[model samples]
Target: VSQWLKMKGKDPSIVPLLHPPSKEKENVSQLTLEPIYSSFNDWATQFFEEKANGYLACKLCPPSSRTVYGPKTNPSNRSSHVIDKHNLEPPPYLRNRKRVREVKKQKQQTLAETPIFATTEREKQRENIVIVYATNLLSASTLDDPLWRATFGEKLAGMYPQLLKEMTIEYSKNLDKVFFSRAFGPCCLMADGGKDISKHKLLGSCIKANGKIHVHELFNTENEVLDTTWYQKYFSRVITDIESRSNLVVVGITTDNEKSVVAGLKKVVKTNDHLIRIACGPHTMELFLDDLAKNYKPLSEAIKQARNFCVYVRNHKQPLSALKKYQVDVNGNPVKNPLTLVLSNNTRKWSGGFLMISRILRLRSECERLLRNFPDVPRLSWSSLEDARDYLFEFYLQEQILQRDSSNLIHYAFCWRQMGRHKDSIVESLKATNHDTNVLAISQCFVKHQEKMEACRVFDLCCLLWPVPPKTNNHSYFVNATAQLHYLVLRQWKFYQDHADALQLPEEYRGTNENLRLTFLNKAKGQLTMHYEAVELEWRDPQHLFQASQEITEGHLRQTLQPTPNLSVPGISVEDYWRSVACLCPELRFVVRILLACSASEACVERIFSDEGNIHDKIHNRLDPAYSESQVKIKGNFLVERERKLREKDFGFEELEWEEE
Candidate 1:
């Protein structure tokens, strides 16, 4: 710019003298924080690497004919490259030699054995025929070692087309028969629903409880009928084929909060049994976010405007010109987004793509009366407004208090208590935002809550529901200590009400009615509610419940043993169990594991997910080549080490021998 000034008839020396080269005439313009990069090539290269640009990349690929191959070789019946490149692959008959090799081996074996054992050729034939007819026809294929290389093999079979074509078709037809049978096989194959981690999409019935969380299978109602509902009606028949398993009825389900599965299941469970439903913790968290905007109206407006500021400023001249002239400050870090995406000005740290946008909104607001011009923007999340308000109101207090507490127990106790609302806020916000950051934050914030809640529920539910022999005695605290307690209390009450006449009944029934239990529960609850309320648990953290409950009096079994891990399985390490379960239940494992691992009982699962938000859709393609995930239904974390172990294992379980776990 200084050299240009010298060439253009102005004093070039003036450029160095000015602290900044550009400023508005009114002296009211915002200072440009962006640093100018010396290398446009490096800048542009780094700029396009972010995942957000991925969608746009697909649009840039207009079709072309592979840039045209080469001079047309003498036109031949077979592709020249196949003939030239893959001669060793054999013609169709020879390729099928492996298929027929077993028969040839049998014939060869019979000839050898027949000469030694038979008196005559005809006698040898009868002996061989007798053994051969009884022998099982077999080729080496297995459930564990299914041949998937056929996909690549078919592509390689182009050589000797006339000789191989018919054989290739026969091979394919045989493979197809195997494939169709597998796909149509008993749907004992239950893949995760891609959203809900709480409920498996099978004949899962609610375990009776008063405040039991309703775990419901999620399904896409708009496009196709889901397995959840299909199994609901036909599960009885399906189970008959396997074993007759019973179903349980409860208040509702805990799912990702979609109405489709919830609604369908409600219809299936409908009867005089009395059932309704609700969304799971993650889904409910979503509700809170949208509600945030409606309640904290300002934050909603701010986020919407923040979003619009990015869109609006790129079209407006003032901001666009300023951005073009401005250099990004962080090593000219090749702007995290396209110039069009970041055209608006903002003064905040601008750490996030969204926050950067929000800052732009702020910058635009300062320049123009944006708030007054637009009262409501469509699709602006409500939680953004509520989150801003909570940060200023509630979270601010939490941050200050949490920072000052030096003693861990007191600090943790207070932090645990103080953090409940914030976690709730984050979970709600994340659910609303569908933003992994918010989800992760929620997981981290109130992980204790989930730990406590799930632990209490799991123990209570399993003990009460497990088809085990009833013990001579059980304690109130033991049953109630579990997550299932409150709901179990309710179910016990309902069971009495339905069967027991309140005033005049089987004397046995009257003793166990809701009125009788409520009276005792109200008194018991009165003694503890204040202390329990001292720190409400975080939903993301399931382990915290056990920890928090540890402060309470011990149960009979617990008095002798350490508190059981809140996780569903008992024989495995909590961490290891959850690590594997996360594959089967990624979202739930994400929430539960974070809670278990943290001292404060708030694992940052939501935060971690937020950090990984860009890869949510990319996870399948980005597999670590371990875990043998390709062509399989579920995949997980531990990718690199898993691949290393898989290669070492030589693609089979137990090193050439089969063993049951």
Candidate 2:
């Protein structure tokens, strides 16, 4: 404790002297035998009189013991000296405690006389009120509500401009810092057009990098409908601006598969082979389903009949009442299986058709009953309804799975492969239901797109880089996939071999021979192949038959291929499992990290469009486009910064502990 106090620059040694000795008397003797003085003023004014040199004659001090104490201009100072040195206490009128109390009372009285405007607490209160009022005004927040008006005062209602000006200046400074920061990775830029409340089309671009939305900017499109050339120029400028500001490399761009958008992206990708262009996955899938619904005769007729039936029930009163009547329990309470066709629209999500079909099928018996009662109503064919359900059941389930967000890098590979399986299952089910190939032809169109999606080079690599082995988990196809990956790697090696003179070398190998470069490539390829074969062999030889003599024995391979019992056991995801065994495939880990950062869909940017605030309402139509853009950018970047800081703190602490150990 004493050392701590000394470190704090405190005089720990003087603690004992702070409390004086108890031997000293508590009350001192009165110094004078004169009559009791009324007050210090009365005593000085009556007998001694003040001197010219700011001193007062102390006649009482001389009579008691001491030489005259000259300073009486300040009565307290004189009394303290008399009490401490001369062993004398002051009279009641001149007591130090009473004087202090009177001074405090006077201060309180002065404060009571002051106005509320001059006080610091009231100033702060008013400032807060103005800020809230201004925010409500600028954001088009409901100000007329009695509840809001009662909450924040009616005063300072027009303070929005002042607050907004100050905020804009401060926000600009912060945005500059964010733009210049080199924290983000190579980004995927996504742009799509949306409409404001006034039906004005707004072209918005959002940059997604490092698993966060880094920026979202909106531009008023005016009268120019986005054409192929317009989009090409706009996207190029967007990329250059983002790269210049954030130091981000533009890796990929994603948009819906609109005709104009597809053409625009084609133009951008023509000369930029290093950059990727992705047709928004969910949108592509939605379009495929839309086409299937239109072209497939049985499904089309079934859906049309269902829609007509639903419309008749909704528009006519008798059928609607009957549906409610039929949907009741034994105790007379209404059941909630009320049915509607919910006809799919173009803007509906990918799963909209499936949901609609499922609901119609669920109410099939009820619909049949309703149809029997209405003689004039056209009937829905049972075969058509059954066929449509059978064809769509597997697809509906598959779409549900695909629409979910996958957290792991390996899931991209896993999901696409599962999609292939779902397509096959749908075909087999269709074959069993019908002998004809008419339905099969329609399904193959979607299957072709799925195949194209799986052909993405990075996706193929991710599949090959999956940490586990094939045979034990029933993945024979991966063997061929691995060979294809090896072939791709060899092609790159051959290219580098041919262009050894033109190749940029690492710092350590800048002056090395061409043979050394080939040797390095050969060595790396050998290690990768060895690791691949060892994992495959261990999976095939589950009994450990080849354990004794091999360079990477079956036992070592088993340890690598099998998940750790406590660490990679059940309930752990594939991504987390691969992360745990990252040491096993150190070379693959880097590519996996980069591929994980790449989004498979434009869902992030679509979400940005859907996040329009009240500031975009018609009431606030005159609001500056720059203000809207900055607001979104700040909101998104602030969230990203918060998550990044938290993760850094958590992982950094864990890393420090691991290092110490």
Which parts of model 2 are misplaced by more than 4 Å? 1-182, 306-351, 363-382, 393-416, 422-440, 455-661
TM-scores of all predicted structures: 0.29, 0.43
Best by lDDT: 2
lDDT of 1: 0.33
What local lDDT score does residue 470 receive in model 2, on the 0 to 100 scale?
27
Total clashing residue pairs per candidate?
50, 0
Q: Once superposed on the true structure, which residue ranges of model 1 sit more than 4 Å away at CA?
A: 1-192, 195-252, 272-278, 294-297, 305-490, 498-661
lDDT of 2: 0.47
Worst 10 residues of 1 by lDDT: 134-143
Model 2, C-alpha of 575: deviation from truth (Å): 20
Give per-residue CA lDDT, model 1, range 295-370, as digits (tens).
4435445555555655555566655555443434457654444444333422221112234333343343232433
